[model samples]
Target chain A: MKETSLQNGLVERYIREVGRRLPQKQRDDVETELRSLILDALEARGDAVVDETPEEAQVAVLKELGAPEEVAGRYAAAPRYVIGPRLYDAYVRVVGIVLGAVALALVISTVINLFQTQPEGISILVTVGEFILQYISAAASALGFTTIIFVVLERTLSEEDLKDLKDETEWDPRTLPHVEDHDRIQPVGMVVNICLTILAIVLFNLFVDRLGIVFMQTEEGWRTIPMLSETALKTYLPLWNISWVMALALNIAVLQQRRWSTATRILELGVKVFTIYVLARMLAGPVPWLPFSSWAGDGMQIVESLLTQVFRWAMVFGIIGTVVEIGQSIYRMIRQR
Target chain B: MDEIINNLILELRRGTLMLSVLSQLRERQYGYSLKERLAEQGMDIDQGTLYPLLRRLEKQGLLSSEWDVSEARPRRYYVLSASGQEVLAAMITEWQQLVKVMEHLLPQA
Candidate 1:
């Protein structure tokens, strides 16, 4: 009885492996059929007992049937891939560009850090170690995000649309665009926006304290001055979160559609409007700064006022940028009509 | 050269597999029995390929199946549907013509 149960267990485990890979709807039916077929195959061997087949014999039979994934692939009607051939080229290109950009940024930042701090000996080794760690994390994140975007594209893009993209005869070089076509959607740029928006959402919501200017001093070591007013952040965070999330969805939509449509343009306008509201609220309210009494010293007041002035100018520029975006969205909508 | 020949052979057999499967399903047989029957007739097909092909053909309405719970293990039996017979007849005619063409085109081996 124990031997029979053990043999059945082995068979059941193999069936479950194959069923896991199959779609939910077909899973039960396939598993039932597979169980029956496997038992029949085992029975076909003359020396095999009816119920108590040896482990070696069962293993041989299952091995002959093939690996669970291979068997499941044969069962599945649809082509299986995380990112299919249709989007594979674009996926590779985007990953290459992102990693390259990440490498370049790391090199540039490291150069700037070295110049600013002028680290020596052990500190120089520490800098190099930091660069290596940053590069690895950044490259990994870039690859992860790029792959996720391509996987989404693969799922959302219809076979007909992908075929149309590949149809070179339909795409003429002359008809591509004369000047900088504002109607054209850039996929890489949208992906970058998505990554940055995600990072911003995480930073502003979870790690708000990290957003500040850091000062490196020999006497007191590193000190950071908090830039955002607690009251301002509390009032405007919800609005900021909403706009960021909306922008993320809009960028993904544009990436999928591969063009700027009237609908997306309208959505973009809505997000910009929200951003403008947030910016306007910040500008009208108290200066977005915490108390500067934490680390007071010589030239501290000058630095504080200068930073406040910079924040005001930044808010002004932000509002202007948002207004320009709204104008562009409206112009596109009209032109589309 | 051997690999190329093997690949060509596989490609040649790919279409014929469906026809062979369809021809066998004229009578009711369960998955294992059908696999055994095909292998006996010198067409060796693995269980993985054969089982999925049966399900696909059944899905396409060329074959119909039912579970026979009377057996110790409930076995799903498959047979040609009305449309399946008609398709098989048409496919046989096409196959004969193709064989004739091939015989004429190929050098005497």
Candidate 2:
């Protein structure tokens, strides 16, 4: 083999470089093994040409062995992928979308607030600063919440669960339905409807003056009157409130389910039936649908009867329609099965 | 295209690399000799990959190693442990089953 100083120095330098990177316990054994390997390759006849100098052959052998650090790296334990490679992209995307959504909401609120109030220079600056602070805080909290969820999932979920998650993401063409535009749930529309429904509930229950009609001035700016009678409201408001909340729960379930599943359909049907029941009860009870003055007498009585009949028929129609929908859903589910 | 194929090839070979090495490690062999033996059998393992893989297998108690300074050039020779032999046998059966499946699906041109 090469007894040359050049070859010896090169081997020592390479081994030392690798040894430096390796953990202390593994260092000696790995270094010894490497040195023997390098020397064995140098000694092997076919590996080194007879014409080449010992140093040249040693250099060639070292090159063939690849980088010293690279050789050491293979022995090291693989990177601690806490979230794993498969889930990392999804984690990033979820965090980004959640945080971005928070930021967007903050931006929208700031813009709405700006429109409401005329901003003098210092006041505008202060408002912008406040918006930025709120934006960062909300975004940070959202990101933190999402990250904790993912980390917990990563730690707690079994390999099978993780594999199932991976399969869900991969999305096979064979698994997809034949229908085009497969995503049937209108998430954006549902969100807008949910928000509007919430606003309605809030106004009806809390800010009744903001809702209904505004009458003429009564020496206190303008007089606003409640559309429904107090007795009617007392009787029906609680029932209607419960119905609204149930409707909200139903929509949220729909939004989460994303498509029309049997469970969600049943929930929708239940909410609809419950709502119609409440409406029917309200119609039958002492609360008048429209508040009217007793001075109108016969005219008021006729109008009241007409409205009552209209409401009863509407309730009946709603019940029938909902029942038909439930029947249709059941039929569809049976066909699918 | 080349990089894709290269990566594909590396991935395909990754699991079998350990199996192939363990098969030859039934007999005591030093790092360079083991590399040469694998090459002779058409398993073109990188030398950098081999040396560390041997240490890893040893660390996992699949292989046992001893330094023989009795020879002119002191060599750390490695041989398969009892556990390693059992693992290797199981791996071989799995590999044979995989080959049969592959042969059935991947017909020759």
Candidate 2 residue runs with Cα over 4 Å from true position: A2-8, A45-48, A78-83, A86-125, A133-337, B1-6
At residue B33, give the lDDT of candidate 1.
Answer: 98
- Tens digits of lDDT, candidate 1, A1-337: 2225744477889999999999999999999999888888877753544555466667877888888999999898666789887688888888899999999998788866765575533564567678879999999998998888887787788778887778566566888656777779778888999999999999999999978888665577767667777897888889788988999999999999998877888888888898888887766566656756555655587577556544554665688778987887787677767
For candidate 1, what is the DockQ-based docking class? medium
Task: Give per-model TM-scores.
Answer: 0.47, 0.52
Model 1: lDDT to the true structure: 0.82
Q: Please give the distance, in angstroms, between residue A250's alpha carbon in candidate 1 and its true position after superposition.
A: 54
Question: Per-prediction DockQ, in order?
Answer: 0.55, 0.69
Give the Cα lDDT of each candidate: 0.82, 0.77
Candidate 1 chain B, poorest ten consecutive residues by summed lDDT: B44-53
The single-chain TM-score for chain B of candidate 2 is 0.96
